[model samples]
Target: MTLKHQPAYIIKMRAKPGQGDRLFELATVGMEKSGASDRFVIAREDEDPDVLWNVEVFRSEEAKDAYENSPLADELRDEIIGLLAEPPMRIPVHPYSALPAAPS
Candidate 1:
């Protein structure tokens, strides 16, 4: 079996009142349709009444890229952008590790 890589992204948005719920719903649905696994709501911080933060981790960067290019992604992006009070903040992460076992 091929091992999947780790990909994590932190998305920060300043959303208008009542917009977070819709954005969350749209994102979750789109991610699932694009082959994402182990999805969960990581955290929601109330920086203020009009600002919010979300951190989500995916199984691999390939999965995340596929989701980004989906038709649902386009729709979600448009809708979410319209509701955002500021540009969304996005950061990509790649982690590395060394296996304990080595070939002789």
Candidate 2:
């Protein structure tokens, strides 16, 4: 059985002026295709439109590492460098209360 303590991460980033929407678009597409995040969510800051946050849940540490080593990751790294105001801050997390989705 998969324990609740799968490797997870949260990334907080700030976009350049007028690029928040574009960044959001890219994140929506990129995370979906990355094959890294089992659960991914994007949220925008209410007070600061340029601020964007991502919550990612990987199935395992290996899955997360696979994503880190992917060509797409390198590509996105290059792509995002131009879009951000500064380097993104990534925080590693250990979850104790992330509930699974309910049956439909």
Candidate 3:
């Protein structure tokens, strides 16, 4: 089996008032435009209407780096940041094992 990057990233943030949907949209768009993720999941917090969460599994560190350098990031920089109540939190993890071994 071909080995792949196992970088798991978790992002949690609070959207600006009435901007939850916009934030979520931007999140998905960013992922779609980057083409760097193996899996991407988005969700809202149970108790906080403004809270947003994203789980992204990137194919590799190189993939993630490419995403950071992507033009999409610059394109949405203002809009996404404006929709956020504060800076988003990003957590990166290195996994020991995973199914599929590679993202489809």
Which of the numbered candidates is closest to the native, going by highest lDDT? 2
Clashes of each: 0, 0, 0
For 21-71, candidate 3 gives per-residue lDDT tens digits of 888888888888888887777888989878988888887888878778777
Span of ten consecutive residues with least summed lDDT in model 2: 1-10
TM-score of each candidate structure, all chains considered together: 0.67, 0.89, 0.81
Tens digits of per-residue lDDT, candidate 2, 1-104, equal: 25476888789989999999988888888888988777877999999998989988888898889988999888887888789999999999856676778899
Model 3: residue 92 alpha-carbon error in angstroms: 1.5
The lowest-lDDT stretch of 10 consecutive residues in candidate 1 is 93-102
lDDT, candidate 1, at 80? 81
Segments in model 2 whose C-alpha atoms lie over 4 Å from true places: 1-3, 102-104
Clashing pairs for model 3 are none
Q: Write the number of the candidate with greater TM-score, choosing between 2 and 3.
A: 2
Q: What is the lDDT of residue 58 in candidate 1?
A: 66
lDDT of each: 0.64, 0.85, 0.80
Q: Which residue pairs in candidate 2 collide?
A: none
- CA lDDT of 6 in candidate 1? 68
